[model samples]
Target: MANPNVKIWFFGGVNEIGGTKILIEDLGYDVCVFLDFGKSFSVEKQYYSYPNIPRSLDELIRINATPDASKMPVLQGLYTQSEITKLSQQKLLELEKSNQFKEEQESNIDAIVISHAHSDHYQYISLINRNIPIHISECGYNILKIRKWIERPSLTNNLFLLNVHTFKTGQSIHVGSLKIEPVHVDHSIPASYGFIIHTSGGTVVYTGDFRFHGHNPFLTYQFHDKILENEPIDVLLTEATHVTKSILSNEDEIGRKLQQAISATERLVIADFSDTDFDRFRSYYNTAKELGRSLVVTLRQSLILGALNICEGLATPNILKDETIKILIPKREDPTKPVTGERLSSWQKIYYQHLGAEVKGSVQSEDLWMPFKEMLAKMGTPPEEKLISHAQMLNKSREYVLCPSFNTIGDLQQVKPAAGSVYILSTSEPFDEEREIQFEKLLNWLELYGIPMLHVHVSGHVHP
Candidate 1:
């Protein structure tokens, strides 16, 4: 019953957990749309690691990290002018010689619809041509913009000036012979969505990494009910990540476990979880409130929480207004001096200023800094007491439920945990060797401090 006019191609996300790229082409209308243009961690890891990534889009195409434009001539025009120029210079493709390349590097692909803001789902879009519009949920777009603002600038993260189009749940987008309607779904990250795509051939339901056990299970149920209304789905592209082996716990259970673990410790309680998992952040915040302790988070995480407030319906704590939450400012080379000079990045200075820190002279007047500054202004100024220094943290180890990642775990060297302190690993176990090595290093750090480790987590995926 497959419609001959509609051809579906799966360039990635076939046998891997991430790197999802699905192309839907309507031959009759001469329209092509990609469901998600994401990075393939598995394929990229085969050739490169961190600080050793591909030099150019040509390199990625050569290693099969991204779709090969050489094999698919239609994709040549879909790439950015700079990438195409580099490829042509390297003799990878002769698209530059064509007269069409002179006409703004027009794209055959109608659109690239992102399911969420997770790196695996939308990271690769940076390499594509900006002419091809990108459609993402309003919340997802804000999250990505904030992430790009905070992270170190790179070619791979050229998202500051993207031609992005943000939509809300139930908003339908038209892309020539197709209608893509994004429906909200419950996932570890906020603004996750599933698509009900209407094609000339048939209806395709693409479930983009969903679960029915998260804080917003009702959203998943609503997605299912929406799919039910669109019966006779010719194609069902679902995520079966946890079908074989799944965790049997929910957010409420994880929260209760967090409370129990923190309550048992009279000294410092260090919690480690994914930075963007706002639900998990809520759990830690509530636990700290219940235990009469302040929830201390890194400055980066505090900025993310502030940006997430742009999305309505997401109930993350207002860090600027929340008295129980505090922003943890790690010590610079000069512990006594305020964070300034070359020590702080551009976004870091902006964030510190937003938190009432004396970093006014460090901030620049560049246009790139304006959006973030304007956003912080709208969020209002955080209390000066909300900023906690590493020295202060060391002095008050017993009064905080500190949340730090492996990257920031070195802070423990300064604020050495007391005898009764405990470290809770609230994230999933390492799935690859690289992360396993990092986890082992983290364990070594804790063991050196004589702090016992406890694993208390619930998988983001649902139990099949």
Candidate 2:
């Protein structure tokens, strides 16, 4: 007989980027633990199929984020090629038929632990019968629930959701013979988690999506070392999101590069990165201040920042107005909106006075701050608007830090750098050849300008 306690199965994310199916056979209990079931949208869906988005309707049941068919160019479900979308429902059926995922009879399966709220990681969990106990960080749980605001409720809701459970950082519980500890880490999202599985084979770790830049990267190292010191080491699973050559660097290095670029560019120096990552947001602001530029985002970004502060036991990062560091958001659409530009700028005026840099060409200072001042100035703009920005530092045009930015490979190809700009890709390459075709298209564009590109990211999952 096979070793009763051995957890054996194909590690999905190992060979490719999606379908993270891990099987844990505990004394023949046959519990399969799934990490993620997301697909990288193909270039065809994102770029080529523009103006007319064709979502695989069958896939809607398997994933959330319902697209308004009435609305043109609305993309729901994780990004995938048109072809992939076609096969998604079929593939899921195959997996289920082959006993790759949970079935109704195996109620003894302990629980499903979701790391953060990324669709690639958690949306499929919704498709899984809600009856299986669901474990996740509070941040992820709320984000997942908030989908009602963007998509249909029933499209996401399932019967199994009734038993959902939330876990806080450093919390642990025993499920069957396995003890799982939810450890917190830094990611684009606020509450990403890594898990520690205690078993007879030894202690195993599954760090979902993590970075070392935030307040506690070293702390994560400590947790891993401490656990490894006491328990027998068997398998250490982590994401190699940044395993490419010198293409990817740790976030700290990225921060330093950002500072240099801001200082070098004498223009407006618009820096575009993730608004969700508190650390990145702070880093960008700090770099701007150091280089005599001000920081700014839309009103939506400001509100989200405030929300993040309330959830984590941390103070809102300060913006210096007088000292020259300023955070600006566009004006609110309606008069009754919660936060707006005028009110933010008036406060910013105080910081502007303090920094003295507000006086144009003055030396940069610290303390004086402003929030959303520019937005207040744009209050009277017309209803019709267009998306066009020539800033050298904008992120790859993503509305949110966690979701797919472009819909297809063709969409990515259209992005071109003017003579002297940089494109920093912070994740892994497409796992399949068909997906890589888009990469080829993107590379062709980069070659035109001899633009130097780098994959400045770190791993989110562990290697075999």
Candidate 3:
């Protein structure tokens, strides 16, 4: 009898809403690959809550974040040598006695193909051994790279740093005995992809988180046609995020709601959504333009857009060239007092460097610390006849759409939305108990400000 040609294993993202880790073994060729090594979104609730996380990676593994396969002998080759060594001290002693502990270490995992850049889908990627090669779309790679900058402490580290090799949509990638073809799928984030793997056992399809009702529904349909063309698929691993089937609004519906809310309001309009959701960004951006209002974003969002613009394929709003989009540069602070440029943190310096790098190659502290208006002037942006300062926004209350992230909510106090103003919650509702706590605080702030709220959002995940 012939030996089994392939073996499949599930490590995470099972019976849960993220942290999916699937291992496929090409036994015929003695190689294996992972579809996604994501961290669960509820990691804070399940294991470590904020301000109480373990100090070291060792502690992190003992509590949570460690895959169950760490102890299984069959998966010894799948994890990195360093990881295995940390998990098995007794085994390390045994290896030392055998005079094999000093042997060179390497990763057994052949490749890691990320579906998207969402934290639940790819955040835990930093946990994988850096030696293993990573494959993602060009846009996804650029997004991650941009995130690695501007963000304090950086998103990636040695344990899970990506040796990224980007591929275009529908490009075929060969890894040992298996062939992977990435199919572009429209999701909340740019560059989301589903995979069609050709295995010796049978053809397998894994639909990464995707939705057809987004701005680009054609891409999802294209994916459908491609998968159907494969004829007989032996296995299909699909994401059922909205399986319960709630009455959900598509992007178009959400846009209409936004338009009505903006038209009805007589004061400042502030819209809150995921910074990475380019579709929602576009929706608000277009609405702002139609209303002769500018879309105001913080430096981080502008940096994100700038990165997207530089990336080859992803469709992003032109924050730099477009007069309709204005930036609010964050001020360096010292105990609530604004500080001088010389006192900026390392990360802030990186932000200035990124902004300057976008304009040209030079990175001057003066250029870094310039006011948003001054920076725009340096970038050759026309003088802001309309969108300029917080005071200006206050004077012309209904002339702009302010996009503030949760962390930047304090800015709302400064802007002070007027009585008839509306706060459009264009993001997700808090479904988790822990997240509900945060949402409650946000509601408290809205109530205090007396701003009417409107929930106009579309889910990025398709219904079951």
Candidate 4:
């Protein structure tokens, strides 16, 4: 027999920013595994934008979720039985079936090792076969669990039932013929990791997504010394997200600019940024506390911050315990009726209870804003500091920093910020025409509200 050979095929994340899927097969052991089988954000617009999706595996393959696995016999179990039936009906099932096909195999994959919990890197995990053992860091898995709760539409409780094999950093996981060692790497999101694989053929190092100037550059250095420098690598796969251009600023520099903007503005300052970025969250949280103002956050953001605070190594501030942290429970946007617990879904109810937020008829009503105003009063501001109207917020523009996103632009219209108040654009700018249209619309909204928009952003990716 020929010497054992290793064949590597990439199903995604080739020439794009995300949607990475790497398949490795050790012919000697007749076993195969995957590294970061994630969905791509780029190809999505080619098919569906929102509220539209492929109903079955055949449709998904046509749109490119599991593109290469369709023809591979060994990976047939990755799809659900009903999905396989649909594939068979379409004559798209090319895998040779054995007599024992009546019983689904234990797994289509020997194992799956995930790099991080970013949707682009791990969104399609639900499509994987149920029996396959998923190996990920404890921190990464916890992030996924929190996401399942916060982002109810993307995933469900079914994810919690998967065969998860949690590991720690620097620990090795042994599958049939592959030994995968997860190495810690820093990224915009927490619990991101890279991998060092030992195969019969040679050693392989896969950098999922990394940056050196994050909250911890030392973690990236640890990865370099422990895996890259020590191991003799035959195949090295790295991400070049920022290879074409230089990074604008490190995390600290971005924080400094943000502090300046916050200090100069004396009104209700609103900063729009990526919620998954905990480092940014820290910076804003600290600035809000330092300036003696409560940082107002949305329900989803509060949950994410609460989760990260409990999670180890992140060093996040406990929003629940901190008097400076205030949860801004926006009124449910149904113009036809008053917002109440009866109108909320089960998840929304649980989320509200978790935050210990008081329910009122509407967030726009004085009753809803009274609690925060009370807190402000106790902080030495007078009862006259209460925000009753957009005019009031404008007059007291120096009191708070409201964190909002593009999707919640409707709320801004309700708040009707004063003319001098600033809108800090802390997230990435439009990279595509579709996003550019949205950006133009956002500017129009701010212009209509008479608020000046300021651009101060930092890239999520590292400078290569």
lDDT string for model 1 (1-464, tens) is 38998888888888887899999887766779899988888888888877786777778888887887657855656678664323311121123223244326777788999998878889888788877889999888878878767765454665644568999885798897688889999988888999998888888899998888888999999999999999989999988777898677899998899888988877888888887788888888888888888988887777777677667865457878787788877665333456664767767777776676666355454444666688777666676588787667757777898887547466677667776789988888888887788789878988888899999887777668
Collision pairs in model 1: none
Per-residue lDDT of 195-254 in model 2, one digit per residue for the tens? Answer: 777765556677776665454566567656656664655666776665563323455776
RMSD per candidate (Å) reads 4.9, 13.3, 7.4, 8.6
lDDT against true structure, model 4: 0.67
Local distance difference test, each candidate: 0.78, 0.46, 0.69, 0.67
For candidate 2, report its TM-score. 0.57
Model 4, residue pairs in steric clash: 19-39, 266-397, 266-398, 267-397, 267-398
TM-score of each: 0.92, 0.57, 0.83, 0.83
Residue 90 accuracy (lDDT) in model 4? 11
Candidate 2 lDDT (Cα, whole model)?
A: 0.46
lDDT of 3 by residue, 272-367 (tens): 988888889889988878778889887677766655665555434677667678766543222123224565443455444434421222334333
Residue 337 lDDT, candidate 1, scale 0-100: 56
Clashing pairs in 3: 126-160
Off by over 4 Å in 1: 83-103, 333-337, 406-408
> What range of 10 consecutive residues in model 3 has the weakest lDDT sum?
152-161
